[model samples]
Target: MNQIDTGLVKRLIGEQFPEWAHLEVKPVKFSGHDNRTFHLGDKMSVRLPSDAAYAPQVEKENKWLPILSKELSLPISTPIAKGNPSEAYPWPWSINKWIEGETVTKQNVRDLSKFAAHLGSFLVELQSIDASKGPIAGAHNFYRGGLISVYDEEARDAIENNKDVFDETVLKHLWDLALQSTWRRKPVWIHGDVAPGNLLVKDGKLCAVIDFGILGVGDPACDAAMSWTFFDKSSRKIFKEVLQIDEETWNRARGWVLWKALITYDANKISNKIVAEESYRVIQVIVNDYGR
Candidate 1:
């Protein structure tokens, strides 16, 4: 994939949003995999999908962020302008109100349990919104917020191929438990990709949530994956208690975490040291939680 650099962004801005064309365009230090995000100015951001697969999110975020932002307590990325495709930029892009906060990380958070509660409260508020006309989980989101079974075969393949790297027996057991039952309740709104990068923190507290590209309505269990991905046992307990999640849903959440960690570990172990290490750490968290 060709990288979208600062030069191309300047051209696109100059061509379309000429009003803000004079503003300096700089690449954010930590951009995401799906999109190339740049600081449009001091107050807004310009996000362009890296490929065709991620292009659809421009419409999704632009159309739905306004509707979802009003009912929720936390601030989310609201689109200010939509950019059309041009010779310089092949796909649709967006100009969003730049959210102010640092990305959440273990070192930055002062209290894990308290932070978990804050996140839990946000999820509760988000889910309570009426999802009658919301989009159902599908390929649009890579099946996030949908059935965990969607990745069953791929997860098994990772396990089978990596028997020498990790504990295959325990991995199989966890996968089986995830497939034991499915979400039976009505679908609710989910952030889909609730990782540290998507969460914003200020003064050691969660302030805003971003990247609604995969936002959709579906089983809430997918959101719970953060328990294993980001939280410790103590904080996980606080999160689950605050959200009032049941045992079945909790188990499914573990499955969601396991599937992602397993695949991520397999894919990046040799190529990306940072991602591989993080994925391995999450895998350990899942195994430890399963044993407890």
Candidate 2:
């Protein structure tokens, strides 16, 4: 996909949403792989999916974020206007009420354990919402909230291919543990992607969560997977305790984290050095914790 620059964004907004076209369109500092986000003046954000695969999330977020926001304790991205495809931009896009906070990272947090508890509380509340009609786990969400076994073949392939970097025996053990349990309970709402980039911090506290592009209803274990990616041993303990996650769920969460890290590290090791390194670090965390 071609990079979405400020000029493209400005032209799209000017064509589709003439009212807001007059507002300054500046590129946001941290745009993710799935979408290009730009700040529209001081109050709104413009988000355009980088490709067709991610385009569907525009409608999904538009349709569900308002509903989810009402139920969630923390602030969420609220779509203000939906943009249609034009000559300049082909994919559907969204204008959201700009959230005022910095994306949370490990270094910026004042207290890891407390932050974990805050995040855990938010997830508990989100899961408690009525998700009877929410979207089910499937390809739309990259099979998140679905069975971890869905990625078993791919994970095994990654393990085998990366034998020089990982221990085949230990990776197999972790994979087996993840496959041993299924989500026996009723499905619940899961945030699908809960990495630090999706979390916002203000006043040294977790203030809001954004990017519900992968939101769905299914095994809550997917949300629990962030415990490994974002928290340390002490903070992870607090996170599990606050959420009251069971042993089976925690094991499955480890599987989810391992699967993502393994595939991500393998796929991007040479092409994208930064993500590869980060994914490698997460893999190490999972292995070290599992070993203990």
Candidate 3:
């Protein structure tokens, strides 16, 4: 919905695939905090990076998508065309195969029991995939970085950029609390960001999972945080049975939700007051339950 240039997109398409010169470019309203996405008809998608800082990750996404798609036994929008991605464009651009479906929300996730079953089945399928096949080089940081290291850099960057939206004292206190939260064993491959926006549903069933930008090997707790987003206690118990996660893993998952919630506010000023307030609600749960 923002001011997107249609002509530039057409030019890029022509440059990448001169054979598709006649195809019309249409804008899709879907986007995330990191990338601007457009649907190129029913079978292809085009993405332009939101910021130069994300170029490296965009590059990684381009490489990893096809690799993981083959391994996950699921549908994915693999890149077809790419731009040089220097100062001229400021950020990278990629065209991908369009994946169709609506994102899952609380409305779509109505039958909590069924939804939990679906999630459990999906996680089992995801975990069964051989990690050795899609070995993502340069992705070791994600598994090991954890909250303690991520917040250190985030705080340092906030200070350097003079983006003092959060008070330093408050940020340090919150970061300390998040670090002290119980973290489980090393990691298994995780979605990293498993919010409602990334999951797709159709006809009351989960059809596809998108947004692989944060896809990496990390704490399974990262994905388990989805329990708070949808599953209630009963549904979550069912989820554990279907996925075969033990109680110790479940506890770490609860810790992950709190830890991820706390570290986020230390860096950026959330634009939506409602979301900020809701995040604080989740933060309070983490503090009372896990913060020692």
TM-score of every candidate: 0.97, 0.96, 0.74
Task: Give lDDT for model 3.
Answer: 0.62
Per-residue alpha-carbon lDDT of model 3 for 1-292, expressed as tens digits? Answer: 2244666677766766677767777777657876677766677877886765555656767877776677664575577777764333566778887777788877776587887788777766665665554433233335421443454565445433433443445435545544554445443556666677777778777777777666665445557777655565678668778877765566556545644554454333456666656656665554443334
Question: Model 1: residues >4 Å from true position, as ranges?
Answer: none
- The residue-by-residue lDDT of candidate 1 on 198-217, one tens digit each, is 99999999999999898888
lDDT of each: 0.90, 0.90, 0.62
TM-score of 1: 0.97
Steric overlap count per candidate:
0, 0, 2
Candidate 2 to truth, TM: 0.96
Model 3 weakest lDDT span, ten residues long: 136-145
TM-score of 3: 0.74
lDDT of 3 at 61: 73
lDDT tens digits, residues 1-292, model 2? Answer: 3358998888887787788888998988888889889999999999999888889899999988899899888999999999998777788899999999889988789999999999999999999999899999898988889998999999999999899998889999999999999998889999899888888999889999999999899998989877888789999999999999998988888999999899999999999999999999999999898878
Report the error of model 2 at residue 35, Å. Answer: 0.7
In candidate 3, stretches whose alpha carbon ends up further than 4 angstroms from where it belongs are 1-7, 86-88, 133-149, 152-187, 263-271, 284-292
Which residue pairs does candidate 2 place in steric collision?
A: none
Q: Residue 118 error for model 1, in Å?
A: 0.5
CA shift of 114, model 2, Å:
0.7
